[model samples]
Target: MEDSEIDHVMSEIHLGCPPATIGPFLSHFTFSSYPLLDSSNDQSMTISVDKDGDLLLPRRRRRTSPTSHSHGSFTVTIQHSITSTLPDVGLQVWKSELVLSDFVLHNMSLLNGLVCLELGAGTGLLGILLARVAKAVFLTDHGDQILGNCLRNMELNSSLFHPQAIVNVRDLNWMSEWPVEVTHADPKPFCWSLQDFEQVKSASFIFAADVIYSDDLTIALFSMLKRVMSLGCDKVLYLGLEKRYNFSLDDLNVVANGYACFRRYIKEDALCDHSDKKSSFVGKRIDLKQIPQYTKGYERGEDVELWEIRYLIEGCPSNTILIKIQIKRPTNIFVESISKAYQALTDPGFQMGIALPQFLLDIDGASGGILLLWIVGVCILLPLVITVIYLSRSSKYTGNYVMHQTLSAYYYLTKPSLAPSKVMDVFTKAAEYMEIPVRRTDDEPLQKLFISVRCELSLDPKNVKQEQAKFWKQHPAIVKTELLIQAQLTRESAALSPALQGDFRRVLELAPRLLEELLKMAVLPRTAQGHGWLRPAVGVVELSQWLIRVVNCRLFPLVQGSLLESEGISPFLQLAHFSDAVVKKIARKKVKSFQELQEMSLEDRSELLAQVAGLSATAVEDIEKVLEMMPSLTIDITCETEGEEGIQEGDIVTLQAWVTLKRPNGLIGALPHAPYFPFYKEEKLLDSACGCSVEQRVVLSWTKVEP
Candidate 1:
């Protein structure tokens, strides 16, 4: 079937448009092509329409291979009479039949009267169509053969080009720098510089299609686009990319990353305006009409939505919003999450080692924290301690070996088992309790011992549970008792012969694993049962386990003087202070206030409770009823007076003062301000009180007036 016939069928099927006939009248339609015309010679040629109404040219008797042509420039001839036509190119015919051609053509045609450059202008059909309306078109390709073929194609239908249209075909390898100008035979100068062209001088818009399919090429294309756009382009450049499913997720990620990285750099440099200014390309408000529809061949089914992103070139430079893309797939969520996480981690303002707020770090931080703790612990223990100590003590000392093994296990398991800094704090506190100088070598034995203990505890859950129960029964303070035992064992082991020291060190190393196993066994049942109190219990047990590990790992080594003299335990000590502060804060704010009851009018009390509640609950049933009964009642209060008030208590005084209500411990419920006292004034004292005592005091008691 003819290209026109196929297009008619597709248009009918997809667009609900009536089919149009591809009759003999269409044969006279000549698609424009630019021939390599010789400027030195003027020749007249006859042209005629074929029987099918297509433009016909003379055909060549014999065909010359494209490779046989001279490398500089050449032309070809057709020998067929002006009345007979040849078949259309297979690919062009196929593309013309596609339903998406209408969409692509519509968007491309909108760049009318603009100086546009098309990269990788295969066959130059789209570029040629663009030149029909564009002020000027520069069509480029990396292959000379392709350029030649495109020039011929353009020449064949030159009548359709605008009278002022200037089409210049050139070879442009994207990886290389573009040259300033190229000389042509038409006596008109063609220069890539903005200074040479009025349209280019004002603004140079770039249009690309099907460009981001490969990693290296996509990078090169975008890199070139950035360079070109930065070179005096008055407005932000427009990029129209056709999505291709052949591209892998990895490739898309690379492109997305590169775009984000460049955008960030531009923001930091204060180049692109990320706030206030509207995009010149897409305009300020992105209504549904502004978003382009996906062209056919880009996707298979019904029209897929195309996303439009716009950025203004002036205003606040740091803010960039993703404007109009709808997330439809599950992987889209994951990709978005990863992109956000990558940005947060790489952002310069983001702090490492500290736990950021939940909103800032997101849920990924929980996983990141685990990995970071393990890495930091490994750094502190392995190479820093074991390697250094082994080299220094070259006599194969058995006592030192045993001590190192025990401490190493303790350090490893404990630090890895808790929050990074919290584990460090436990070690510092243990060192203080043991009165030992914290040293690097001391860290090794504890780390080793912790690791050994962790391994053993994991192997026997029942045994560890029994041990935990026994310890709890014998000593109510299990953690403290265990620490004391660990300290005593370390001291005795250090006092023994080298072999005995090794044996004791080995046993001490098992402490962390045993404690962890016991804590796990105790907490597992509660966790499985979904008990409400399980959280606090688990937290306490974990803290206890960590404390034991720290004692065995750090404190024992410090007591034995395994560390060097220069290193101070300040970092560990600071961590302890932080942990204490966290614990205190948690304890203070754990529940609402607890205070003795005081009688008051329900109406006044409801207002006070309303202030505290602040939209949490609408009303309490009994309190509402009580408030209705005691609408006005005398309430005891203390207040601070500001400004002038000239009257004594017994002088029938009338004065204004701000009233403040106090809670327990004399803490003010709120602040002294307006609305609470729009007409707050001291009225004349009422002596009509039946038998009520009227006492007033400057200090704690009220002063009394005898009736």
Candidate 2:
């Protein structure tokens, strides 16, 4: 090569990570394939692996596959790997830092000329990125090595900062108290200044990325967030995270222990708003789709996410007591005393004949305590259906039938014409239009049911824009239909006489072929609307309003939910024990949901079944069997390393799971009544038939290999 070409090539030397191990080294995360900005800054980031100056480090086998990236990127110096200990793991450029950087660029308007501080700012890439717009940026972290590396990276990206940008590198330990006195001796890289402390306390925004991993470290981080976020003036914390999971012996299941630790801080309403009554940290997930991936190169996998959290101004002080709530697991006596049939039954594969959702719907809210069992289909345990208790609700629910009935009720009220018990209307309309036999009855038991989060925030006028930005996740098919309809309308409007552009449906009439063109892209289904049904009509309206910020969209491939009734049929009937005559007698009572029955007291249940509901004593006995099987089990779960109290990423921690079959603590009702959540002492008498006391424990190991 010529001298000029060689000079140009040398100028473009950038960091190169080996495939053997993972590094915070140069990697790309592309949310978009199209160019949203000109002049990519991430180019020419050459860190030579051969030499120190040629800081290009050889890659090692990474724990996961390398992600891709695209448009408007940046580069920085990163350590090949950790040299000191756990905290130094921050030395490398974690992908979370890059992911958060994209959000900063997209929301530059909010950060422009505002005080911003980054929590545990490892490599200073995120803070440096913020330096371009933030009025003042404090890149905070502990350790002289990481602090110094971050400072150097600041100089490396100095060209990217605003002309008057003030960037400070300082020490902030998560374990220490707030306003940590200046611990750095003279001549060290960073020391806390009074002014810097004030700036941090009054900052407009706080950002942290790739900071969560260890169980102990997560607690420390949460404590820091609570303390720092509470002191500041109405500041929002944008956290970027990647879930790392592991297999454990305690539950003998793969679990994200560190992530689980982090989730304990979230309240049920946290996802809805930044101001919640339950916890100080009110957080909601920021949809990645709303944030453009302008800094391209990496594939933003599903596990990676960003959260927008607000520390409620009226929150309790930092000194608020930290209650360690752990619901105790059931004892062997508790489990064995409840289900003697399981021990005595010969067939291990005996069908429970009940779906998990049906069981959940049967009982009213478990407000007292929850009975959690480890339910496994494996015969290794010989029909030991352990009820594992989980205090926290999973963020995502992936069942087909759970919310179907609710969905039907919600969507029925959407169109005034379809208001009362018109769940069957959705199907009849489609069947009438297509002239096909509607193989689905309203009571046919939904095959693939989808129950979205209730329309609490979606229908609210104040949350329109935010709801619009996130609706794609819930109603993809409906949104697609809207997109096609809009496209066709736009095309017809362009071809029509200006006067004819007003009516989209009229334009469709004007061009009969346009209707046929649309049918080509139809997402059709078979019996039961191809078995894809959505409960809650508001969910449909919410989706349409989100895409157009208005309500003119198609509602196709969406069906309503139905109720389950017990007849003489086996599994088809919800209550397999009830005969056809018994079902008719129970039907006269008009029990809308099983929760209605669950909420009744013992006397009410007996009277309603035998007298008011016109049921015989035998039928009442069958009702008791189902209710007796449900023990509001309390699950006390915790995780820690062999000797340590806190668990960090990569540290294998024992996840201890304990389940209780009855209320060992809390209220013991006088009558055989339905014990609320966490307490179920009254139900124990139902298992009098099974007196054998046996404690069984089974363990399995799963070692996942990544290629």
Candidate 3:
């Protein structure tokens, strides 16, 4: 079929428009473009992206120091959404893109008068900058929304480019075949002509920013790169990637998975023998310090790395190898090789149409009798081994472990002769108190990580509720105040022996001093102890809930998930003062929030407390008293949806959500959310939150609005 004819016969499928709720906004990046070309060079450049709301980018609070020099500059605006699901995250520009922009703008001469292509041009902010010096630029990406936004940006910063600069927004689907067969039936824009296709083939450089994130996408990107670069060995790809570390289950450690995949495909090693030179792909990491940061906004974290990649035609032509290495272990030998031989032959991969030699088939045929016996042995012994493991672990109960460990450590810090060393000793024993081994091997660092994470206390306004946000910011001694409060609260519940009472009381008297060590160690945020990047991801309640979840799901079927389900766990910090175990039992049940936990129709609170292990009568009563003081709120919601013309796709509609909260008996007034003064729309949503005492509120009072 003629290519032009295919364009006419087939239609292009672009992703449908995203919801209007998450519509386009603008984000501006202002920076100094160095080395002025002429008097016309703009020293102050502002690049705007489509991501503006009440909040700005990461370095919004930071301003550039005044510079005396004038240089080249431009203001670029991009149309983008602030957030999207992982797969469609291309709709938003990322931190790594800004870092890459600074690198490119700083080294402008390197790209002088060259033609280049961008793999994932996303909004094309970088390409718009490239168009300034490049002869021709291909702003390519997949998906309709991404391309549409990229084109919009191109139109926005048209003045930034020279009159002769040629920039094209085109389709580059990584998963699809390259040299896109655009037929006459295809109605999509940016269909390439034979000449344009040749220009892309001859383009000297390929630019990509923050494109390495997902494993599948990384694989597809390299696949496309191999095909494209194979056509021309002179081609070099500039990849500005941010290594995002995550805990990998397989590796049992934190790793940059996307970056690891990229490394595998490039096959580049820091130290290698002559055999490495025969590898088809070569990669080199560029020193970031060598490139001055031209853009001002986000911090260029250490995780950001830039690589210069090239494909070679000089390597072994076939680049394919099959391997079978000998394997043996001292612990166990498969003397039953007769039965084990079938294990490999029955694999799914072996089921493929791969042919086997006659000798291998003869060996497998000889193992039939032994294989039958092996299966029988596994069926009988597997059950017994599981039964023994389950019986031993389930019956074991580590009672009041958290209390014994934490208090025991504090026993030393509260002494009259307490020294600086004593303070450090307490923290060093933190993991031991938490029941984590003091001498753990390299593989068991995950539990220690959880302890540090659980200890995090975010005082950031964005993370905390509006009322509590101001309190933490205004207080000069936030750490001291918080630590003192925690100590005071816990001291009341902690039943101490007479011998331990004096030292423990001293701890309460000097509570604020405790937080100083944590702050000094950088374990907690410095001045902005309450405020941070986002709402806190961990707390005592979260830690408690996590443990309960793990304990509830034992390997062997037990008396866990079989129990009654919980309505929800209230996000209250006061409950943590009672210890994580106390909160675990509360979260395990309860038809309501913290306030309603006392509303159970039991004869007394002790009746319910009895179900929880490690609680005395006095402690049970104390918990009940705390629950009574908490704020109570029950919610009822009604939604009304209707249209005179009937609701249809693409039609404007109103979504009205009527929310009402059932408050506790003594409250009087229409405003159920009067807890905070000068009520705003955002604060109005707090009407549904469980109210806490003033002290408890600052610790934690999370609210969610269903409407």
Which prediction has the highest lDDT against the true structure? 3
Candidate 1, backbone clash total = 53
Deviation (Å) of 653 in candidate 3: 62
**What lDDT would each prediction earn against the true structure?**
0.38, 0.51, 0.54
lDDT of 3 by residue, 1-707 (tens): 57334321100111222335346767665556542222122345455455553442222121224442222234566777765556556677776777778778877898888889898988788898899899999988888878888899889889889668999998888888877776777656876766678888888889899889778999999988888887743688888988877898988999886887888877453542324435466778888877776665456678888887877554532233111112434223455575588778787777556454466457847766655676577777788888999877554422432333344444433332333323323433342223322232311332322223323333354555663445434322332233322323322213333433443344333322323222223222323333331222122222222122111111112223422223223233334234335555655654224444545654545666655535677766655554443344333332222312234344344443334433334332333221111112222223223243122222222222343
Sorted on lDDT, best first, the list reads 3, 2, 1
Cα lDDT tens digits, model 1, 579-692, are 223323322332111110013345544444444333223443443432222111133442212211232244442222322222333432222111111222222111111001
| Candidates ranked by TM-score | 3, 2, 1
**Which regions of candidate 1 deviate over 4 angstroms?**
1-112, 178-204, 236-238, 246-707
For 58-174, candidate 2 gives per-residue lDDT tens digits of 322112112422111344333334222454666666667767988887878888889998888977877867888888999898888788778877876687689788999988889
The TM-scores of all predictions, comma-separated, are: 0.26, 0.36, 0.37
Candidate 3 lDDT at 269 equals 32
Q: Which candidate, 1 or 2, has the higher lDDT?
A: 2
Q: How many angstroms is residue 605 displaced in model 2 relative to the true structure, after the best TM-score fit?
A: 99
Worst 10 residues of 1 by lDDT: 684-693
